[model samples]
Target: MALWKHLVQAASAITLAAAFTSVASAQETVNIGYTGPLSGGAALYGKNTLVGLEMAAKEINEAGGFEVGGKKYKFNIVALDDKYSPSEAAVNAKRLKSQNNTPMVFTPHSGGAFAIQAFNEQDNFILGAYTSVPNMTERGNKLTLRIPPSFAGYVQPFINVEMKAFGKKLAMAGGDHDYAKAWAQLFGPAWKQAGGEIVAENPMSYNKDTDFYSGVSRVLAANPDVLFVGGASEPTALVAKQARELGFKGGFVVMDQAKLDEMAAVVGGMDMLEGSVGVLPLIYDKRPGTEAFIAKFKKLYDRNPGTEASYHYSTLNAVSEAMKLAGTVSDPKAIHAKLSEAYGKLPPERNPARITSVDDRGGTNANIVVGMVKNGKVETIEAASLGQ
Candidate 1:
């Protein structure tokens, strides 16, 4: 009886080991690379977006690793902290490509996106960029999958609204980075077209311009109707806070980088955000499945997902669906084609709340919906997209 008992225990161990090996064998893993500011001043934006991407991966794995054309794949996200530096983004991209053979990479920063885009096609990996710079897809890079609407999309709703409702004369102040320059270019012309004038343009270095009070105070001196404050989430909030403390009562532009929740936390609620206009995140956009996504995201990350997370989630969803259709995750051309195809299939009813279209250039066209902050919450106002 003792020998029989020992044999049974041995058999059980063997069976468990076989099961584990089989589970591993059944699912094939594909590592997706992400390089962004996982630490430093922009950690909130980068980490939250990483959470959204991982959340998508989790859901896909839970649903039994999608099978396409008899090929099964389990996706894993590989992220590295770039400290929000473009050179670091390139270095990490090389590491991810060499070490992990990542089929695709997501970089939320425009400067980093540019770095990735420069060689991604030659490297034969798809570039999943969250930057809203209008010219990203215009470069005609097939591997470039720009997931968010261009800054041009924010013009009609954010700038135009602030122009008419708040005041006609507007002032712009932000980091003199390429992304901010693109935004200023787009918004400046849009406001000009709307019969408004840009009173002052204040450009400062992102890291050096920590004391926004000094610069913003000068911009406020212009006494414009609205101030388009640009930068990462924390800096934008700081600028807004400084503007408020300086007794400047007017509208603000959140520059697509700042999350309302984080901004509220920093500036003490939505009282300072009244008449502010900017990207409406999932928590406020209420796009189809937005609330569901928000609930799931909150449950996983224990915080409200802002635009960074929501758009990353949407793009990650698009990428997954594209891979499933393309039947191969490593083929750049196939994945690129399927991305646009998947976008066509995903609608509001199909859980496509923010995205409206994906053009051939791989540029996404999401409808313009600006959020107005009221008492620490957001109120959304839909507006037409660029050229609409």
Candidate 2:
């Protein structure tokens, strides 16, 4: 009888331990990964994106976190610095998937975003981003979602205005970066489609070299009526300054990467930006919903929100809403499906005017606004113009 009692006690202890372990495992926290350039030329972009994500996480946690299948799971962010390198992004993606068990990743830059997109496909992880690459969502990659308007969508309005103002004879001067190259590839076809002629195309390497006199001279020799300056703030500004200095009085169409302040500062104030058109929607414009976001972002960061920051914030909101709607964080596939549905079903108060719907491939049907630099700031020249 003593031996039987001892055996029963051991079995009871094992059962209790197993039950406790199961409960603990079921209450695991939900982890979300954010990958971007935190220590390179694009560090500002990554930093701003992180701020947005942090804000979203704080808001969600304040609301008692996300409820999933009758259980409450707190949202946690695991940020990995890829330094804007494709290889590093790939490695970071794998780590987030395997070790962190992250079902979704938010990427900011184009190269890193595309790298993660490729990895997500192979690993069956859901990848979302504010990066504006149309091809990222073109093929119906169910696991991929884009938060911002694609480069193609954004560029169309600028192209339309430029073609109408300056008769064809286009010259492309864009950075050699992935995003810029992608823009260049689309520019030729897009310009041709608008009945414009491409006189010459020149790609310049930026971030390392600042002297764009040579590149500007080359584009000048083409004698095009207008030049397309594609790349981030610094390079675009340098190109514009150098082109103007070289006595090229032609019109300039800056890409989305060229922020108004940076362009004006680089090219000797708003005079250079005057009459120049760009693709990025102006953030500080007097839009109905944007004012609240701008005010809140300024209060938190103590600075005006740029395109990178605003887009990142919007992406985070989209993700959080999807999680809430799905009511579970276990299956990434289900979460992705929920995201698509939530994106469309979001109430007007939760939805931004820029974004309308998500297609089957997770491409956002957002309308891109056209703006021109006037008086040292970006002015919305076209309202609700879907350049398509």
Q: Model 1, residue 387: displacement in angstroms? A: 8.6
- Residue 166, model 2, lDDT: 67
Per-residue CA lDDT of candidate 2, range 82-154, in tens?
A: 8988778878889988988888887876677777766586787788766777787876567988877676766
Steric clash pairs (candidate 1)? none
TM-score, per-candidate, Cα-based: 0.86, 0.86
Q: How many residue pairs clash in each candidate?
A: 0, 1
> Which 10 consecutive positions of candidate 2 have the poorest summed lDDT?
345-354
Tell me which residue pairs clash in candidate 2. 68-327
lDDT of 1 at 58: 85
Residues 294-343, candidate 1: write the lDDT tens digits: 77877876877766777777777777788888888778789888887776
lDDT computed for candidate 1:
0.79
Name the best candidate (by lDDT).
Answer: 1
- The alpha-carbon lDDT assigned to residue 63 of candidate 2 equals 79
lDDT agreement of model 2 with the native: 0.74
